[model samples]
Target: MIKHYCGIFGIYNHVEAARMAYFGLYALQHRGQESAGIVTWDGQKLREHRGMGLVPDVFNERHLGKELKGNIAVGHIRYSTTGASLIRNAQPFLVRFKGMEIAIAHNGNLTNTVELRDELERKGSIFQTSIDSEVFVHLIAHNMNGKTVEEAVMAACKRVKGAYSLIILANDKLIAMRDPHGMRPLALGRLAGSPVLASETCAFDLMEAEFIRPLDPGEMLVIEGNSVKSYSLLDEGKKPPTRQCIFELVYFARPDSIVFGEDVYQCRKEMGRQLAIESAPDVDFIMPFPDSGIYCAVGFAQQSGLPYEHAMIRNHYVGRTFIQPSQDMRDFGVQVKINPVKSMIRGKRICIVDDSIVRGTTIRTRVKKLRELGAKEVHFRVSCPPIKHPCFYGIDFSSKGELIAANHSISEIERFIGLDSLHYLSIDGLLRSVSHPEKYCLACFNGDYPIPCAGGGCSRACLEVTD
Candidate 1:
């Protein structure tokens, strides 16, 4: 599975701001699971609740109603892309500087973190956590002298490069900003006449908020006293080209979301349709590996005029911290996560549809189980092209060494995964499935990173693919 770094949600001018932010983060739980936090700004002070676990595990009725009383709130769910998983790295990182209390929740990775961290440390700027998100707080603080939070934010943004969809709670105002490349998703909404912000529109549905629109690349909006004002991060007479993360549509986003001004379900369904057009393997029935692959499998089944079956049953009750079986059990985790329906799989030629293959090991184990179940043939269809590159701007395949396709050919992957055939939606097919395809960051598939990262790129193994 490709793990996204984080998800953020914020609300301003609401009586139950923290509660609403909790629900917003709950809806965005799929984006991260390592940690969860919420910060609330009362008229006179800031309150916080952060813990290392799922939203429900971290927060309760008591935390929301009693501890986090405020009219403004910012929430974060983190999966740790730039820092180790620790309580200290949990966010809606709250800090007090110069009589102003500020809290920030971030939703993307920064490429120049090392340089900025070095510079800050040299200037005696102490860091409390190793997460790159802290750099924003320090930068904003450094610029806070003789400047409004807006000016500080703009100045801080100007110095940093890469993906960020940030929500800041500074005193009584809630601020939202997106990177110039728009490498992450952030949506604007209205709830009960209060302005709200989230990493995806799906949160709006949960909060009963009206989906206003997506925040544009380089756009910053300041929400104060039920009013919103927009500002551009771009220099005058310059509009940066949009290079939104395509992986959000492919896997990171919920199917119910509207990201980058497009419907995620429709895009995934179209990708499945396109995959069928390009590589429709002859099969008796189509199946998905459960939740992740269900929508795409539906599209494949519809396009191929084949039967759609729930051949694999997912154990929804499986907890994130399930007790590990002894090493002797081997594929115990995978087996418990999902089990093939014996009746549906025996003597069948099945086509399994999925979003994308990351490491290929888990799928290989699942396919091996299918063989044990007496399957005639197993064909795999991927809705997106092989992820051949690392992503520095958020979705966590940070090392080319971790990507199977980055080191091996299509046939090699097919053999390794024990499939009769493995086909991926071509790059053109993926583009055809979405609107304004030119605006997407296809860096994971093409290695054309919009903002270069010093510590990220193709590894020697990726370079060896063509050689």
Candidate 2:
């Protein structure tokens, strides 16, 4: 599985704000797993609790129902994309300056983090964490001389350039903003007339909130009580074309969520349909590796008139971290994660459909297992085009060297993975499955980066951070 970035949720003027934020974060747990935090603004003061673990592990009834009492609350779930994974880097990063308190939960990576950090350090701004997100706090604080929180945030947005979906709790006001390019996903919702914000619509589903539309590119909303005020983070002439991350639909977001006005499940299913139309091999049955490939494989089965079966049963209890056995154990890790259904695989020509193959190692091991299970032929089909380039805007993609597709040919990858035959969805087929294809970022597939970085993803070498 790919590494996740972060997820943010906020609600204003709600009686159970912290509890609601907790549920929102729980729905968005897929977006981050390293740490979870929540900060609230009670009438007199701000209270916060942060811990390094899943949402349920970090928060209990005592922490949510009693300690975090407030009408306004902001929460964060983090898997570090910029800094090291440390408890100190846990978010809803709250700070007090000039008697004004502001807490921020950021969802995307900034491109110019190194440059901005240097400038801020020279100006005598002491940094508390080694994260790029902290740069936003410093920038907002620096611009808070005689301006409102919204104004300070807009000024800060102008100085930095990159993808960011932000939820900020400033004193009694709850504010939300998205970068001009719309490189990340953030949606606005409402629950019993109380305004709320989250990284995905799935959070609204869990909170039983009404999904109001997604925030427009570069739009900023400041909410207090039940009233909401909106503003643009950038001037009209300065706004660039929208470059929404397509990977959000391809892999990052949950199928139940609505992202960028598209139903994620339908989008992925259509991708499978397009793949079947482009290339459908003759096989006894089609199956997925479970979870990630399940939806796409369904569409492929329907379009190809092929029977679908669950060839591999995933061990639902498998945790992200597991104990290892001796090197003498063959394929112990893969076997524990998923075991082949030998009754369904004996002498069958099986076609496996997956989302995307990042590194060929994992798929290679699984394919070898299928052969040992008495499968006649193992053919692989991918629903998305080959990922030939690294992603710079938030996604923690492997470098060119590690990305199998970036350095190997289609035939080479097929041989390396021990597949009888392999095929990937064409770029044209992938674009056909989504709306406004021109507006989506295909940089990872086509190598046409919308925003230039320091090369090999966001350069973190200059920053004094360790992972």
Candidate 3:
């Protein structure tokens, strides 16, 4: 039940830009469920429609076909990490500066939000939303200084720190950029000869767009009327190492997605294979927690020569339980979303495979349910290493205190979850499972943050800057 950060989509010079963006946002709906939005430009004026709900609930045929008429557009699906869950913070944030209108959709948290906001506020710049994403718009607007919009965007990027994948819609151009560390994913694609961008390739798949490639760290592309101009913000030989969030493959992204140029499903399967090789427990059968755990469990079962079964069924309609904001709500959501099959669980030594354990509440509750359903023994297996540090980038894992592994020993966690035994993929094992392991950020598991938070601590207040 890990909370995803956000998803962004943009298209340039497409006649059905708003409709295509709707489909793209629909494909990326799994990334965020708190709110959805889209802003379009019809060569003369900007049109916008946003709401605090799922994609289908927010946009309809009328809004896409008429109200949001445009040949260029940007869309967003948000699970707030930097702001409170309010409609005002729903992104594709549109603003007017010097008689020019611009819209931006962002997919990461800013580490220097507090510092930047303070500096701006002191200089008579009024703020809009509490979200750190609004900082980007302000920075771009104030830094224009006779420079082109693309140049202003790059200049603004230099003033910020931490993970960000951006899709910006100006009056005449659509722009996309990735952070210097590439901590978040942004992909370039094409649909009917028009340039498009999204947080993941899964969106491209849904729209029948061809993925060109993932944007390099610190790279910006200004797309105008099917022509794209690329620029690199980093100086020669001064580029920082790429540190894409490894959790994207383990949990955040769709299994069918190609994130950071690697297949997510294959990576999870490799993780499961590595888990089997490193921590194979004696069990009658392997059962995945459902959905996220299915592919990993298959790999584990295959590697261990054990049968795999769906002991728990998931309700697809229910949103992710981990992002429910409260322990009581998360616990309740888990119960309503997943139910154990009594016939499959009775009198069995079952290994329950899951992606990762954050607070341990959801897994603990599910384990209790299994035991109540007559499971003789529940051995818990995690495909990823223990999350031992808070994520300041985009993930909702905000405090070290919220991470069970950061506070308790493995055996203690096993006892707390009421499992017969528990095993998590080792850090080294998890690293070996991915391509270009050195290019990944594993701070949540190892406490080696690729980018340090502002004021030198990973506290929620320091990273998020909600004020």
Candidate 4:
């Protein structure tokens, strides 16, 4: 498991549904960057093509337009949690099962997968992926004996635990479901006559789809023929308290998206303001790392009465260089991904706002660029608190040792990132940014995991892997 395990998107009843799904996947590409895939349904057939690159790299007219068909389509970008990080684990895992052609795209990791998988093995079910998600099919196969697909889904979900937001294709109906705790984000969108479902609302914004509210905690959704039905999976007293990940606002979700009724952009702004209050940095200008840090930087600059500037401009076309699996790739990745705007920050006492420092490799490189560009002083302002624990719900914080903040204090991190000062937003302020401040999860930042961490390492509790 890495960080966040890719985003899932689907579009229905549109002329260019596949392309729309591609755009949706593009908006959510941050969730997972390992690989990307899309599956579309023509009235009579299913068409899909995927590869080991970004969404644009995987899809094009020659490859996407001709091979992809259908009014309904599902898309996924992979960030494998427990299984092999290979083409096979790259989802939307499509298979013909139970006399129905099913394509399943999932976000989040399932606990109790091993037990469920052993049960399927006992029933003669052959395995495919190392993903906990694939165990879901086996659960449905072995446990779903109900009359309708919805009933079968409800039946299968009853057996599982931990965070999961999923979309299942069963012939005519497209089903989307979220774990009772709602650990991951899933939203339903509408475009003209089409109905869509995405891991984030940013997908809807990309296609001009009207953003709909998040699926209720413990809600089951069935989308078919441009309409949707929702039902709660738990009784009133049995509800799992809502714990949407706080990192979504700080790092994961696109700024344009809304989750749990909070605007990601606004939430980030609030985070920066809080970071300002937490760190109370003495600086000349508030600067952002660009892309993810813009919103938080805005809050920092406004609250601190410091001007905000882009000290570094990211080359969007560049592949995620640090995401490379090898040393050559990693070094080359940092080499190619960013270009410092020296003129914008040649000589300033800068307080740079960022989301969080994971491995600290990327931020260290970024700070080096700022220092090299002749900045007199560079201070790091992180919008979220220090991350000491790995995430098990869905994100791939696989190892505690890899985290810079896990073993070091703010002063130590300042030395590592080569900053004159380093400040992180307080956990309390981060929670305050959410629209419903009390409802979201802050396990990664605070180490107070709402759900169980399962075990120490990623192999046994595989989804917790963070590096």
TM-scores for all predictions: 0.97, 0.97, 0.96, 0.90
Tell me which of candidates 3 and 4 scores higher on TM-score.
3
Q: What is the lDDT of residue 100 in candidate 1?
A: 94
lDDT of 1 by residue, 1-467 (tens): 77888999998888999899999999999999999999998789999999999999999999999999988899999887443788988998899999999998988877777778889999999988877788899999999999999999999999987789999999988889999989899999999898889999999999789999999999999988756999999999777789999999988899999999999999989999999999998899999988999988888888988899999999999999899999999999998999999998889999999999999999999999999999999999999999998877777686878999999999999999999999999999999989999899998999888988646543333211110
Candidate 4 lDDT, tens digit per residue, 204-259? Answer: 88778998678887999888775788877786789867888777777788888887
* C-alpha lDDT of residue 203 in model 4: 85
For TM-score, candidate 1 versus 4, the one ahead is 1
lDDT of 1: 0.89
Give per-residue CA lDDT, model 2, range 297-412, as digits (tens).
98899999999999899999987668987898878988898999889988999999999999888899999988888999999999999999877677777367768999999999
Worst 10 residues of 2 by lDDT: 458-467
Question: Clashing residue pairs, candidate 3?
Answer: none
| TM-score, cand. 1 vs. native | 0.97
Task: Give the poorly placed runs of model 2, Cα more than 4 Å off.
Answer: 454-457, 460-467
lDDT of 4 at 52: 82
